[model samples]
Target: MSSEEQDPDYRFTLANERTFLAWIRTALALIAGGIAVVQFVPEFGIPGTRHGLSIVLTAGGGVLAALAVRRWQRVQAAMRRNEELPATRVPMLLGGGIFVVTLIVLVILVIWPPVGQ
Candidate 1:
């Protein structure tokens, strides 16, 4: 890489760093949510439903956390090299994962109809 390309504009680098932090925060939130669900939330009517949900949320968070680092590195490298930034499936995957989780909760709620409902 060219000497100039080795260190691109500071603004872009800072922005990339911010994005990485945001993803990390999101992952942390997911992990915390998983813990909260398992600890505080009452069990669903179906066996293992609560634990299953917790596992999915926690695992998704772990995956996102790992992917975020990779994404940060890839973006930083591309920025330094002045190459086109790579596209990512992170948003799509996160959305889909959340959607599936929501569906699971919804199905459980409908089938079990939580207490007093």
Candidate 2:
């Protein structure tokens, strides 16, 4: 093993990597959900709503994936330097973003009319 890997707590480093991977998986799931919603869901009463939701979801997922990379890098660097973990704003930001998206989706669902012949 290199000098870098030999230093610091292996368990903590591995845990951090695991957390990063989990976030990436979450982002992938979000991307898949975006595609699924766009492809599988019927159009809403308002024209273009399905497209809007799909765009929003896909964009959010992309942004989150980028954030995951950034967060992982920052944490890894801090660990190498033996510094305290950086303040974690990513989780709060993600939660707030998803909350807003859910509210918007729920509103759209309520407004959407039934699809019938």
Runs of candidate 2 exceeding 4 Å displacement: 1-6, 114-117
After best superposition, candidate 1 residue 15: deviation in angstroms?
Answer: 0.2
> Which lDDT tens digits does candidate 1 get at residues 1-117?
667677879999999999999999999999999999899988788878888888888988999999999999999999898899999989998998899889889988988965554
Question: What is candidate 2's lDDT per residue for 1-117, written digit by digit as tens?
Answer: 446543558898799889999999888888898899889988777788878888888887898899898988888888887777889887898899889988887886777763541
| Cα lDDT, all candidates | 0.90, 0.82
RMSD of model 2, in Å? 2.8
Each prediction's TM-score against the native?
0.92, 0.87
TM-score winner among the candidates?
Answer: 1
For model 2, name the residue pairs that clash.
none
Indicate which candidate wins on lDDT. 1
lDDT of 1 at 36: 93
TM-score of 2: 0.87
Evaluate residue 67 in candidate 1 and report its C-alpha lDDT on the 0 to 100 scale: 99
